[model samples]
Target chain A: MSFEVEDRVAGATERLLGEGTPFTRLGVSEIANAAGIARSTFYVHFADKSDLLLRLAARAMDDLRDALDRWWARRRSGDDRALTECMLRVIDAYRAHATVLAAVGEVAGYDPAVATVWRARVDRYARRLRLELEEDRRRGVIGAGLDVEVAPFVVTWSIERTVAEHVRSSSPTEDRALARALSHFCRSTYA
Target chain B: MSFEVEDRVAGATERLLGEGTPFTRLGVSEIANAAGIARSTFYVHFADKSDLLLRLAARAMDDLRDALDRWWARRRSGDDRALTECMLRVIDAYRAHATVLAAVGEVAGYDPAVATVWRARVDRYARRLRLELEEDRRRGVIGAGLDVEVAPFVVTWSIERTVAEHVRSSSPTEDRALARALSHFCRSTYA
Candidate 1:
């Protein structure tokens, strides 16, 4: 699909969510009308609602991964500020598509297809986190007496689950506090 | 319901699950037939399949909580062996109702009623864990630089999620390794 068409769908989806319609309940005609496009164009661009949701999930996951990648590239050992900034960036990425994420969260719980796609993305992040922890352990600075195998998953999910919870209701101070708590635990455990 | 009736239903549910029927797909008549009870007897006890599921969840959660409570009663701070044994007991309780827990895991993902009950139980465990951590911190044995508010939730979920994953397919060696990995991480983080 063209960028312009994709943009239209994304905008329409958001409006639908804002109006209290669930993604699962959204009709293709409503989406097309909201996007000021023909119904036929909707079918031409996507096969079904499930496909659209998967695409939205992909878009959001990509955005989140990109934000984290930037943090990982510049991160330093024991640098609390770096990790906090990384979490803040993650919160921003998730908040950017809050509506889509909310819908995805609900469906991913029950739908095998959606759950599989979502879990695969989480695993990708965990894999990268494991690699980073492994590298940190080589320098003998962090992860003493801790299994690199297990600590990474715990730490990754700690921040991921915590950040996901905060996105639903957020404040700058609260986010900062959360990041601090997580950074303290992460650094202390690994260091 | 009488203990005999409950036992029969539980046995029938296990047999159904063992034969590969998803809990949500199970029929009231089928359950009644498998239990060797009249269909009227089933309705007299359960309002519906949903009610049956809720009861099954309650039974399993209670069993798991009792096992954990016993472990917590004997738990000593920084005792890796104690924690490992606690997890082993938890694994055993869950294994006892493996059929029901598997069903609950799937439904709890999407069913609000099931999810609410499951989360509330998890919250109970987290609250208790936080209290224990606060006590240990006061004793100056662990949790030197962590938030009582956040760390408990993370630790609870880390072990909870890890255990839930392991329950699907398990071995004594694998469970021991998992328990040890968790014990090591938990000890280092809080100690």
Candidate 2:
């Protein structure tokens, strides 16, 4: 019941975002109006706007992980286009919720809780990347010269910052170029 | 006359930061007290906390570019240790003003003007990296397969984020390791 209400609010927020409402300009009352819930119900479901954004951002991160998994599976199967395919999926995942993610970036500066949550999630992904690199080394795909220790931080944070910034600012026409850049970055660095 | 006051405030802020005061917790009066200036003088020289941080961050970025130039010059002279030497200097440069940089990251999330200034400067650096890549590719230092379009974003932002996070959170003992990782990352990827 709670998630249903949250989903309604999230869905409505996304629709409002689709119409081009800046996330910072959005309010609970507005979200409630769009979600068809009482303004007070927003409190029952969320502590505030940042709370709602945190939940949504978590969902988005989860989707990105799923998209990454598809890429990993394809790579293991020796698909040459694995990185490119994965990046396109990841870009779409971010594009689907660019506004919410931008809000997360905006709020995360001053909001300690939001920053902590985002950092923790990104750290987990970095660790996972490290594991993947270690496995690749064992499989003899990456050369011994690869510094698995630091390269994960390099690739993970670079992709996150570059892709997030690209999605937030660039025109949709440049998505393919950005995606190509991203896939090429990862392929040359690790593969 | 104005530059004198700004430098005083920046120096005092750095000292207070050295003494372990959180930048967000810092106030105008506190800064005045430390700088030996009137509270009203703070406003005369600066607009607000975020404004002051932007100026400080700009200075820091300038120092960083200077450090990178040293690396570039050293690399031009065929110094194999150019990147390692450069990262050590860059890390020291950040450590000198780590607190100010952290505040910039914090406030930049919500402050549109601050975000814009910071983004423009970073964008300029990314362009510089792109130019550098083109030069390297022309010189045959990097391979033909290098995607000059995207690799600049990869190296520049990746280096910035990884080094900043390390300087902010990690121990001094780990500095050498981090520097080594950064150097190896650039060397293997580019050289």
Please give, as one word, the docking class of candidate 2: acceptable
Per residue, candidate 2 scores C-alpha lDDT tens digits across B1-191 of: 66888889999998887676656568999999999999999998888877788877887878877877676555444454666777788788877767777667656655678778877877787787788778878888886656787677667777777777777668878787777776666665553
After best superposition, candidate 1 residue B118: deviation in angstroms? Answer: 2.1
Residue A132 accuracy (lDDT) in model 2 = 83
**What range of 10 consecutive residues in model 2 chain A has the weakest lDDT sum?**
A71-80
- Candidate 1 regions exceeding 4 Å error are A1-48, A166-173, B1-44, B169-172
TM-scores of chain B, in order: 0.86, 0.84
For candidate 1 chain B, the 10 contiguous residues with the lowest summed lDDT are B164-173
Question: Candidates' lDDT values, in order?
Answer: 0.73, 0.75
Name the lDDT of candidate 2. Answer: 0.75
